[model samples]
Target: MNSNNDVIRKLHELTEADMSEAEFLQSVENNMIPMQQFFTYYRCAIMEIETKFRVLNEQFSLNGESNPIEFIQSRIKSYGSIFRKIMTNHIPRNVEAIERDINDIAGIRVVCSFVQDIYRLADCFLRQDDITLIEKKDYINNPKPNGYRSLHLIVAVPIFLENEKRLVKAEVQLRTIAMDFWASLEHKLRYKKDLPPYQLNLLADDLKKCADQSAEWDRRMQDIKNILESN
Candidate 1:
């Protein structure tokens, strides 16, 4: 069996030399253990972040406050997707480089009940001493060109191992329930390759209109909640 460093070095060589996909797969097959271990660290980091949000939700319940979080979803990027990213972006071909450049190896999506809850949960998560904020993109305030909206955060959290503690990066996306619903449908429709160009354009326009309406709904719901709280 190759040592971890040896496996990393071999993989780096294979990627850097632009080996055939079959050759790369053979190398990966021979050295699956180390690669799997690398991704496992990211999984641990996701668990740590998820636990923090779960605890916060539980605290709100205990205090008779409305739970802000509706649901939490987490995923680790597949190896094939990671490889495509490395090749597409001309990233450095090494384990260290991949870890450094890929911010979303592990991801957590937190769906909140209201727009306000998105920022509230983000603030609470970032305020913790153990979590380090690496980057933040407020797409909710400034929607993307396609009218997508979400609060994206790239954070580093320490994951404890039996022998060492590793700080891994994971992306946290906070969005309102309506926003999530809109995004889910948009993603599904946008990926259909069979759609004609004209139809695609029309679909895109409709999606943008829907996004605007959903955002307005979120605002009105939040206002009603504020009124009730004031009573």
Candidate 2:
């Protein structure tokens, strides 16, 4: 496939061919240039944000840690299916739109010791003139029906590449350590089955209640830590 249209046609042909989904997906992976561009685009997008905001890996990590591009490659390796679906099926609004969605499509969990850090970073990330906030979801304040709590933002950013430029959409998630733990567990359990609407509703209610309690606990622990540090 020379362009996006060719890519689509190739996808259709692959689907029709006498190969399993795994084989079809492997063929797509074998396309060296596009695959390389795909990951490179995502990395550059994140780097742009980091550069714009003066945010280092150390700033986001609780341990003040940093990771190399190889670490990022390892992480994306697990998300191969997500990339495949995007390339073959989800025809983006435009080339720029595709970049924005790809750049903003991933999630970064900011694990803070206190609840306030979540709000603080969200404010900092959203206030940037370069980063356009399309939507804000305060799940920590009004969480999902599941006991999930995280600050979510849908943001649009314009990326100027050498050959072309485009606006991309990204999803940002901010939450506390406790809330993050709950969310990770909740995602694992919920995706285990095809739950009915009523069951989903029940799970959501339980999650909300749990998130509320977790936030309360975070506040209390933060207060105690601050008091000890002060003394």
Index of the highest-TM-score prediction:
1
**lDDT comparing candidate 1 with the true structure:** 0.86
Off by over 4 Å in 1: 1-33
| Candidate 2 residue-wise lDDT at 225 | 70
Report how far residue 53 has shifted in candidate 2, in Å.
Answer: 5.9
Clashing pairs in 1: none
lDDT of 1 by residue, 164-230 (tens): 9999999999999999999999977765657788998998999999999999999999999999999
The TM-score measured for candidate 2 stands at 0.59
CA lDDT, every prediction? 0.86, 0.59
Q: Residue 75's C-alpha lDDT in candidate 2?
A: 24
Query: Evaluated with lDDT, which candidate comes out highest?
Result: 1
lDDT per residue (tens digit) for residues 1-231 in model 2: 298755655544443343543443454433433545665655565666545434633465545532211121112322334444456566443434444445445444455656666676667677777788888889877866656777877777667889987555556666677887787777666543467779988877787787778878988987987798689
Poorest lDDT segment (10 consecutive residues) of candidate 1: 24-33
Measured against the true structure, the TM-scores of the candidates, in listed sequence, are 0.86, 0.59
Q: Which stretches of candidate 2 lie over 4 Å from their true place?
A: 1-39, 50-104, 194-210, 225-231
Error of 2 at 161 (Å): 2.6
